[model samples]
Target: MMKLASLGLFVFDASTFPFSDLNRRRDWRYGAAPRIGDRDATQYLGPGDELVTLTGALVPEAGARYGSIKTLATMADQGEAYPFVDGSGVVWGSFIILSMDERRRALLVDGTPRMIDFTVELRRVA
Candidate 1:
């Protein structure tokens, strides 16, 4: 099995689930002071905020499991930080789940989703 990345206990792989898109954002904080008849002076404060967004689809017919989404929701409810790690053995940092959105499509006879598209947003806490 090929592994892509992992957020705490949730793993991303072909047999389980995989994220198609991974976006990371990093921002720096700065403060500007107005000067009389001159250019404003800007002072660099420090690192502002960092965020990561993962988007993917889960298809049960293709070996994806639906319970993974529920596990993520449970983790989010705990309001704790989890370590984010990539398959390449890179530790991104500790992050907390900011939000999770899921859209069910192609429903089955029992109203279960055949295909589920999901987005998970995380904010770096440390």
Candidate 2:
């Protein structure tokens, strides 16, 4: 499993982003970022909005792949984008959620990729 260092998230109406393997040394490949339409752009996540969250451990290979997929899937999802890395090799994972009204946080340990469920939400910590 991998560790979580810091996370930065951006919410946009829409964005076009390229994809590349986080662990592999390669240039950006053609990809897209999820976007918010003009109408939805006005709806801001405020300090009162509830934030839903999920957490788990992930192997390095699968962790990077999950991260890449979340980055690559923005075109269709068009909601929020979050990317984080631990930089330390410890592989301990941590997660936090900033909602319209509150913040939630959790810690995780290294584990296999079988637990990952892409259909629900993509949680990746490198």
Question: lDDT scores for all predictions?
Answer: 0.91, 0.30
Best by lDDT: 1
Highest-TM-score candidate: 1
Checking candidate 1 for backbone clashes, the offending pairs are none
How well does candidate 2 score on lDDT at residue 80?
A: 43
Report the lDDT tens digits of candidate 2 across residue range 1-126: 222333343221112111111221112233344566633223433332222232332233333333433543542254444453333633323223332111212324543343232212233322
Separately for all candidates shown, the number of backbone clashes (residues 3 or more apart, or on different chains) is 0, 15
Q: What is the lDDT of residue 4 in candidate 1?
A: 91
RMSD vs true structure, all candidates: 1.1, 17.3
